[model samples]
Target chain A: MDKVVKVAVDAMGGDYAPAQTVKGALEALEERKDIKIILVGQEKAINAELNGIGYDKDRLAIVHAEDVITNDEAPVMAIRRKKNSSIVVAMNLVKSGEADAFVSAGSTGAVLVGGQLIVGRIKGIDRPPLAPLIPTGNGVSLLIDCGANVDARPSHLVQFAKMGSVYMENVLGIKNPRVAIVNIGAEEEKGNMLVKETFPLLKNCNDINFIGSIEAREIPGGGADVIVCEAFVGNVILKLYEGLGSTLIGKIKAGLMSTTKSKIGALLCKPALKETLKSFDASRYGGAPMLGLNGLVVKSHGNSSSNEIKNSIIQCITFTEQNINDKIRMHLEEE
Target chain B: MDKVVKVAVDAMGGDYAPAQTVKGALEALEERKDIKIILVGQEKAINAELNGIGYDKDRLAIVHAEDVITNDEAPVMAIRRKKNSSIVVAMNLVKSGEADAFVSAGSTGAVLVGGQLIVGRIKGIDRPPLAPLIPTGNGVSLLIDCGANVDARPSHLVQFAKMGSVYMENVLGIKNPRVAIVNIGAEEEKGNMLVKETFPLLKNCNDINFIGSIEAREIPGGGADVIVCEAFVGNVILKLYEGLGSTLIGKIKAGLMSTTKSKIGALLCKPALKETLKSFDASRYGGAPMLGLNGLVVKSHGNSSSNEIKNSIIQCITFTEQNINDKIRMHLEEE
Candidate 1:
């Protein structure tokens, strides 16, 4: 509680840049006393949004960046060229050990590129996976490699399992989280080549509580605490979860308003239904973290709201306090 | 209306086996005048289930098969060893032109193996894709390669697009269905190695209407009529849709029954809510068809009820009447 964790925020990233980013940082400062934020963007835009916001001057600071990177540009080219951009400057802070972490609601490509290229990878890490917490029936599960590396080798998945375990057990405080590989069938032998090759490696893994293959149907019911997959499959699962949840919820709302009697029922059932559905709302969770990097980098959604940005910034406290990167380094080295 | 479409039903397949399978065949005969079902399973079990049931004997015939290929057995080993198995025998009927189609609520792997090894892939077809019509917001979209042909090459995906187009347009009566490759992002460059290579080939193809990439999020919104992907990605999408749909529906029911006030409201809203939810129920859609095969092969869910089995049988008529195979052959040759 005495020690403070400093996080650098990319104020020029995302759809509502500077405004939402600044507001979110201020909100984080108001909520927690053990965290500090450095907002990186153009001085005029950052100061204009922070004009009237009240916060402890000791906990908040601003660092100006001269350039901005758009989502359309090639990520590698942008990251390499935009040396003074918000994302670049913020990441440089982490790389130089001036900041404990870097948070961005920017172009996913740019963040991923900068996280690996600028911040660099840890000694034993092959690929730094972007792990996100998704809401489930019982609770939340960490889905590793949601949008990081694709066409990942079997060895990459073994590392994902080990790294995911470290995050869930240490950061989330789960006691030996059950790690499951995403598969089409329940059987071990029933998967594509990558899964077939990865299954045995995961089974022999002593660092994690490795469960066997989990079918996609079981994921929503909280079948496992840490779900592992290559980026392509993981990306599909993550996006589909959001899409189908909203679609079904929309259909339910329409059904409730279809008739006069049902409308009356909708009124009575609204509160209880809303209370139950609140747990499944994914925005309550923070952004995905690029694990195995030298320093922490969390990528919030491009369309992130102020609340989401606040949550993303606040979660960095736990990620730092628990010394997650140190634990990951030890676990991976042992493996 | 003019010619009888003969369908061979695997009575010993599925969880319920002869009881549900026999009942489904009878139900299909009652619903349509132009379809004939040849029930292939243990003669005694099928006859026992058929006892005291009134049906036209001319429309339904029994072909006894003593062996049943179970879900646990290796698919290739089972299909090759158990020559008299229901899936193998039923597929043989279609292969010999004795039946227009083969429908089974059996092991998916066995059906996929038998469809290729016994019934054979259509000449020039690299791999036969298992395309299922999934319910979407607007109507239904055909998801190609849901389970079969994992680790697919770029060429296999190109054939899937052609075959899916033929099935959706001819059998489902959609004119020039829009084909979309499933990707994480809308942009062409935003996919794994497989999709990146396949995107331009699809764009260049003139036979089918290629609507670039469709993200998994847009899939449930009826974004595209024909969704194409490799088997692994397609299977995850398919299974997750079933999983998330049911989990949310279950949670909604628990919410509706949480309080006494909500219970009274639930009583008033039950009918309208049920009516709306009925359209989203995937059971109304029949089994997945292994497309680009020489003969029609439908792989129904193992847990299929009589209604689902009946729907599976009834769909074969459309496949036969529209001459789907000839259409697929013509389309593939043009490519």
Candidate 2:
């Protein structure tokens, strides 16, 4: 029998806690028999939600955590003080080698802080970036340092490129992903101080297949497999992309349904349009992995649904199976 | 008769130069009687293109500029060495009080440099931001400092907000425009060094209607009338918005044509969808104005069509009539 990949999930995290998290855990187990889940939250709440769902009892376990980290609390303080918090306890499972991965849909700051302080970093990793797979025209591109490490140096961007390349290759199964640094312009001379300093360094690195600078505009057209930037720029690009996508989609839908003639056309084109738009939905790719961490740490959205949670938990299986951390470590050492 | 808004246009600029520029000039003259265009470029090429179009010859004049600035040449060097370049000559017209505004589709760097160096900044104006009107769900929002000033300070951002608010209110007729600083998060303390420093300064400034910090994701939803940020962030947002808009539009069109059912639906809804999407087109809003300059200098896209150029030329009329520059000077002096 193949080894079961155990993923510790924070049941008390996210907006629809325990219920959605518990349901998502049960769904993930049913979908993959080789997956084991350790749901960490208030035992009674988790148990009440899990009672109706029938799943393999052997594969699911509950680790009672007394405290729950609220989104309003400061991240570092919460992580430091709340030792028995669901986020901290779930992270502990990964730190102690009790679980191969940890997934959370909680406060972003807390997840990022806990991932670094608890799971720790792999050797030679300066900063672990939160790399999310953003949907593009052709497929998906990994946007590294989406939120973590707002003040990243040139070397940190280089490491992000390497780690991003490894994740895209091993987990997403893309061969030799094209890596590009995000800049204001395509020219080498263009961009601010950080991009100007990092451009040549990325070009000189033999590890990454560095395609010169890429403008933010080319990002949506699937310009590169891995897009590297400092956290501030990356975060801006990610948020703008998300905001614009939803806004545009909403506008298009409204336009289509406004008139009787268009409404009839909309009904006929609904299936095809839905299929086309689905390709741009980011949640299908699961949560963003905090790359360069010693153990897998994934952060799902705060308002993640059952499907997103399930996808996030199942996503950890590939991280364990492919040994992404070890590959990242090897890549860093080689440089 | 109203005072003719004299505009010096670089006839030798852009991808489809002389022809597009001359045609655009003639079209602008045909559309508005109270506007005179001084086409600055190589006389032979300008006249050759002009001979084919019929317009009020009295309203259009030709100024011979011996040299043209190519996009490849270094901007500062090009401006200095190519003393008689079209961009420099046109800008000189503005400096000499012969023209109310100067419009160009040439090298952005040269235009920006020449605008500041030749036309000069208003007395208290710290920086002249290149503010462009970007399309959004509800309407359009002005994105200040899209490409001009990269290393902007908190004080510079304050000026951008003020100038952007003035432009939106006086030109676009938006009343008491809501100005917002672009940041990574909605919270007061959730940005990099620049945004952090700029946020409170903007909030405290009573000169403009300063709203709280706005995330990039909220930009496309028309969250603010004026989106203020440093040049790098603003440029990224602008380019990304344009790139993603075009990409999604292309994808939607392709999807609509793929299946027979969709094709039928697309045919039926083609007029409505086209009308809806056209409103979001950035070109309708005219060129990006280099705010805070003594004389209005606008940069149209390098690939601008005749329609865009015509719009850009007509746009100068409003600036001349409303006296945006003098209003900006007064606003800055108050602070």
Candidate 3:
């Protein structure tokens, strides 16, 4: 008999919660026979959505949670007070070994907080960073510490580089993922104090493939497989990437719609152009994982729809099956 | 007669050196009558280019400087050894009250070093930051500390906020420009140690309008007029802005040229589309100034052509005529 890769999803989280999350859960089950999903939310709401779609009952189960965590609520306060919230309950399932992985599209703060406080960090793990798969020209690159921990030390960044490389190689199926420190300049001596200190340390590490400094411009070109940085710089790069992509798309759409002649031209080029632009859509990459935790906790976008939710749940299956957390523990133990 | 703005141009610097620099100086002279230009470079090269273009001799003059500083040399070493270099000589003219401003398309490190060591800083200035005008939806916003100093402190960031605010108000015609600390999150408690320490200091300042915090995504939406941060973050933002813009344009061009149908569409939208995209071009914004210096020192792009050089020279006219340095001094003194 094959081992079951069970995932606990916060069905009442995210913008399209319950409907999209439940639909996504059903999609994941249909795609993978070896996977099981525990939908944590109000049982009535989740079951109604599941029944509306006529999902497979044998592969899907609902675990009731009384409350939902709103995006605006303070992370620590929400985790402390809302113990029975969908996010907390889902993480608790993972903690109790009832589920191998936890996925949430709820408030990022709450998700990150719960993943650490409830799911807990692996022993010897100094910091758990949020690593997101960012779309690139070649395929996708993992950007570690994309706004999980802000005030990271040089040591934390060093750990991020190692953990990020391990995840990319073992889970993403990349052979010897190249790690690079994001900096203002390509030269080793050219960044702020944190970068200057971290560069030598990253260069000294022998267990993983360590490339030199990477400028932010080279990121979209697939300059490195695993881009490492403190959360502040990583967050800026991620936000900037999304902002620029959206702004350009908006501009292109506006330009194409402006005049009668342009609109006619747009119609002719719509199919091919859409395909080209779709390659850069971040939603296709699903959620970002908070690495170095005892159990896998993936944080999806708050506005994620059914497709993104479905992709995220499927992503957790792969993460669990690959034993990413165990590898992270071994990597840390080696140090 | 209107007040004449005198701008000292470093014609012996940059990739094109005297040829493009001289042509640019002539173009600026023709466009604005209330402007006098001092072209400092090798006399023969300046004369050769100047002789090719017809302009009023009364508005333009050449100041001889024999030495040249290459980009690869250390900043301080280049500034010290090449005393007669165009950049150094032009900056000296500003220092001696013979010219109102100095402009160079030369090595950025050389210009920054010369701006501080030659032109000197305003009394009470903690550190002079390089501020550039970035194009946005609401026109343009000034991003301070683009490159002048690295490994900046919380105190330096505070001064940058004050100086950037002054420059925007007095020179850029922005009224009470809102100053925002570039951060990973909008909350005060967020960000690295530098931002945490700098946030309160900026808020306490009574002279400028202070906004709490701004994420990088909000920068292009006209979130704040003066975006203040250390060199590391500021440089990343500037580079990413340029990179993303260029990359998008490249992708669009590649897409349009790939097929016959798209080529036809591209031809139809050529004029209007070009006009729209040109507004976002970084080169059109002229040069970035090393702020808080006693005299104006503008650094143009390394690959700057004749038009960019011309625009930078004209930009210096306004920088000098506005007496921006005095305003910065007054703002600091009052605080």
Candidate 4:
């Protein structure tokens, strides 16, 4: 009865692509009635994978894309040259207003480049930051500029704070999300030049709820709702968070399985332990979004499975429903 | 029988000052015969704490100092004005050749600033870096520039890699230690301008073994012996490493104590679990040394315990014995 929110998905992206992407598309359609998917990839390969999945074709369509972008290819070159590539084609659909959002589980660089060069930025947006929701003990914290703009200025960080606050409030439904700049120390005088310069700017900004500086150690403790930094620092934090979490989980598993006594203990507490660890699993939260863009561009992991893919596709619906880009544009314009 | 390595310790530094510092000095004297300690602090407080502990009085001497640097004081101004501050007095002992090394469980900024201004840099050394040995599953990896100079240039990172390599080989006893730059991606070309520029410089250097770039996710796996980065990135890595380890350990303990069954199992596996977790403790490794200084200056944690302080004091012995600064001078001369 209502206009369908069309999402263009890169079917050829990710490690479990075509099959997982097709399956995810089917799942998204089955779960939501007010959404349509345009699977961009090789026609035959996508069709073969979609044949067995029992889903209504009315909600799904295949857009033929001839090429696939490899992970190692230069982002700018690939975006410029690979016009028919799955990632590029998906972004083109959003650019032409054929789709409301574009989702990819491909090369992070390509998605970021394509998102900017293809779909373009909202007016007054200085630099678009890739903001990801990282799992914390209490709930989730949004880390802006995970790996988009490495050499961001203080004004860029201020925009990140505003946009990150908007994302948390509208899509994730957190009211007055506390925003903080990632820094070496909590003091105003601490951190590098970027942080020192941005601290006062963030404090001065009346648009968002700025909570001041936060050290990396307090991030897992759920101290701030939105943690902002330049891409370089944010990327390091995100990678380290995932690395440390996975490594710790692996060590715990190895410790539990090492001896018979531990094995018995592990078996006894398997259910609860699994639940506890599951709370920290980032994959369940879906992909990071390249914020401040005209249309939604979500970048799922390269090794994303069908479940992660399904969740990422479903995540786009919330962004569309909440009009996140519109809100970002409004916020940017007000400044 | 050999000449004792005299260490000048800031007895008035840290959260648990005089008491913990005196306790550590006593413990170090009892454990090693090859070390003498000059405790710098208020004579009354030092003697009061020292009187409670029995140790070799001849090997332990207290040098009275009236001032103590607070954490909030400006580093440069504090170093300039606080002439007789505990940290400054201790460092002066090293500079005057009365002590081979200086150890401080004090404000990191004061220690760093004093190390540069008082102790001075080794000839040919461009910049001093803070190198901390972090515990890894394989053993320990040297994280250079944990919190020294921030917003570092490519040249500084090159010096870090060289200094870190020297420290790893000489102090840590790693042969031709593999040095790797901390980056977002493994590829040499895939980083910010700083990393990209430093990667080639490190590769061209013939003095130390240089491995390519390493992602932060692979840091815990012991992928590289020496992980080099600018202070900002290095500090983030070090803090996150400590945070994640403590958080995981806390989670494990809480989980084990949750129920009667788990509590009983925890008791059974207590010894093995403790042994496993002990390897990850950052305190066991002691302080981070401000490398490339003419005299050894170690910066212990602000909340360092007696054992950590003792361990740090003992660590300075190895640094002096191995002549790390002289070797750094030789390495820098070649450049």
Candidate 4 TM-score over all chains jointly: 0.96
**Pairs clashing in candidate 3?**
none
Give candidate 1's TM-score. Answer: 0.97
Every model's TM-score on chain B: 0.97, 0.98, 0.96, 0.98
* Model 4 CA deviation exceeding 4 Å by range: A1-4, A27-34, B258-260
Per-residue error (Å), model 4, residue B275: 1.8
Predicted structure with the largest lDDT when compared to the true one: 1
Chain B TM-score, structure 1: 0.97
lDDT of 2 by residue, B127-197 (tens): 88999999999999999989998878889988899899989999999999999988777788788888898
* lDDT of candidate 1 over A28-132, digit per residue (tens): 899999999999999999999988867799988889899999888889999999999999999999999889999999999899999999999888888899999
lDDT of each: 0.91, 0.90, 0.85, 0.87
* Clash pairs, model 1 backbone: none
Candidate 3: docking tier: medium
Instruction: Sort the predicted structures by DockQ, highest score first.
Output: 1, 2, 4, 3
User: What does the lDDT read for residue B8 in candidate 2?
Assistant: 95
RMSD (CA, angstroms), candidate 4: 1.9
Q: In model 3 chain A, which range of ten residues has the least summed lDDT?
A: A47-56
Location of the lowest summed lDDT over 10 successive residues in candidate 4 chain A: A267-276
What is the TM-score of model 3 when looking only at chain B? 0.96
Best by DockQ: 1
> In candidate 3, what are the lDDT values of residues A2-84, reduced to their tens digit?
68888999999898888888888887888878888899999999878766477667878889999999877889999999999
Q: How many residue pairs clash in each candidate?
A: 0, 0, 0, 0
**In terms of TM-score, which candidate is stronger, 2 or 4?**
2
